[model samples]
Target: MNLGCIVGLKEWIVPQDKAFFDLFEQMADTVNEGAVFLNVIINNYVDVQNQCHKMKQIEHQGDLIAHQVYEQLNRTFITPLEPEEISRLATALDDILDYIDGTTQQMYGYGVTETDDFMKELARLILLSTQEVQTAVRLIRKLDDPRAVEQHCIEINRLENLADVVLGNAIKSLFATNDAITIIKLKDIYENLEVATDKCEDVANVLSDIAIRHS
Candidate 1:
């Protein structure tokens, strides 16, 4: 085989598009929606119980998409991607929304009356990361520009790093306060938001690996 043949190769074989790739896109879409809804809560900071309940509904939507991916995987013998890749991607995407919903749950359960700057910034990062993840997922479908997918993955990693820094500073600020109970509540919220970004990075890693393998 010549260099041109290898260089001109497409992104993926995609043996079963509907069974895997389409479902992956659906999962990514739901995750991004959940992140956006979380940002809504972060910005508005009103109707604690109501916002939490609404976020839970969005998370449930994500759950249904994830279940479709898993069920399709079990039924399909030949998949667009590797079986493990299909399963890993589905779970990773689901995890992001799970954390988003979980953080809102904590806010309501902890009786958080308001939001803080740190939490807002972290939620913003989570939103950015999830958007990147969705982009990468879509790119994988056609692999039109594998380089573009890699670039988006790089951005996701950068956002996750920023989330880490935000979490660190938020924790430091919390400790400065004398109210240990308040400190604990806010710290947990910050950590959950941070983890959502972490899951975004995980999705990025998987996308990068898939890109490289088929590049």
Candidate 2:
């Protein structure tokens, strides 16, 4: 390419690092709100449909942020992080919100009449995992301390493992009973909650990857 073309290309690809970080933080904030809403649903166990409705709003907000990230990536060739890394991080973050919303929907749609102790415990783990996720997301912007981000990731993995144990015990206890329909419904709800933690770990993995590469 000619010098003029090369210069134009360079200008076209200027980094908007702050914009991406802001968008990610907005997304993380929205998801955290969803997690809180979920806890409300679990703890209150009333008007679940309406509660799920409110959580849907947060999920929609997260979708808008994810779309903005994709649009930003399309328009900007130069980013503070690699394009792939940006996409992965955004996708992973979005997935957590999606699963959170999924659990809310399942809890109501599957005709779950009450929240069990297992479900409550799973919700707590999800909230804790998202808090870690939020910290990691913010820390990733600077990557000055890769260890800090990795520490958060480690905690996230530990939470996910705890979720696994919760799921296993939940299923074991569920099968021991004879109420087939209740067992089916609660099992689905429990599994969905556990999967939400799995999504959190996915976010941690992406954050850890970004920190390793960028820091």
Candidate 3:
């Protein structure tokens, strides 16, 4: 193997990594749509089962795209990113939808018919965090711009903090109510919302890791 041929081959292999970034951006967009659907289901008092079914479709699509990324990673001889980092990024993005799906399933199962102020607030935070995740993933291709990527991660962390406070206050009030079953149900829903925000933060953390290593 001549030196020039080796360098050219490596250059050709690097472009293949672009597919990962495209798929990641697509997944983030789907997550954003799922967040929007959740908010509508909670706020509007719509047909809960129907909304949940739609959300499931979105989740399934995200799963397919995630698997495609994994398959591509397996087949490629050389990747622009470390295999472990690519795997972590894919899993973190997939987990966001999992949390969203879990939230809707619980809502329908618990027979939640209306939305309270706390649920509305949590929904807002989830949407915002997903937006940040989308931006961060898109910017990740240009790791030299660490400042831009770090800003998104910082915002995600801030949103997660706000969600924690909302969950705490909501739980405190629920404890004061006399209906034990209702209390249990609301607690489960609130906790799931908080967990979804945490998952978004996880995605941000993964982006920060990639940025730091590449920059």
Candidate 4:
């Protein structure tokens, strides 16, 4: 059967399944908004905490959609792509939300009140990564043009690397400071941000693999 027929069958049989992509879009929007909020009110710990909590809920919803997609893909054989590929893509998309949620949780748990330049830069990198992820996901349903996917993966990788540098500098600055408690809190936040970046790279890697395999 053709791709359209398969997708049509999926839609007819699985009513909730169609919402997976929409959830991903919501996840991207939440992350983007959270990043902007963090940048704008980095000094307001309470505001940051509230936004993080909101992000956590959004991420959890995204995770639920990913789980539903995974389960549905397992039961259905006539997928648009290999079952393994679909699983990988779903998992990667969920992973982004996981990282975003975890990062926000740490930001609150650490009671981080002040934002440094490095933290601002890290937030910006996260915004860029999520935007790239959104673009990549939009192309996954198309899958005809590997070139666009490749380009997105490249951009995601670059943003992830930039985040890595920011994380390193933040850590260095944390150590350079004499406040032990502050250093500890900031270190935890930095680590969580770094993990989020790594998750973005994971999404890119999955996209790259799909592109290469299908090309």
lDDT of 2 by residue, 87-119 (tens): 988898898899889988987898777888998
Q: Candidate 2: TM-score?
A: 0.93
lDDT of each: 0.87, 0.90, 0.90, 0.72
The prediction achieving the highest TM-score against the true structure is 2
- Which regions of candidate 4 fall more than 4 Å away from where they truly are? 1-45
For candidate 2, what's the RMSD?
A: 2.9
lDDT value, residue 86 of candidate 2 = 87
What TM value does model 4 have?
Answer: 0.81
- The reply for model 2, stretches above 4 Å from the true place, is 1-11
Backbone clash tally (model 3): 0
Tens-digit lDDT string for candidate 4 (66-150): 7777666656545555667767777776776676667667766777666677776777787788888878877766578999999
Model 1 residue 42 CA deviation in Å: 1.4
Clash pairs for candidate 4? none
Tens-place lDDT digits, model 1, residues 158-193? 999999999999999899989999988998899999
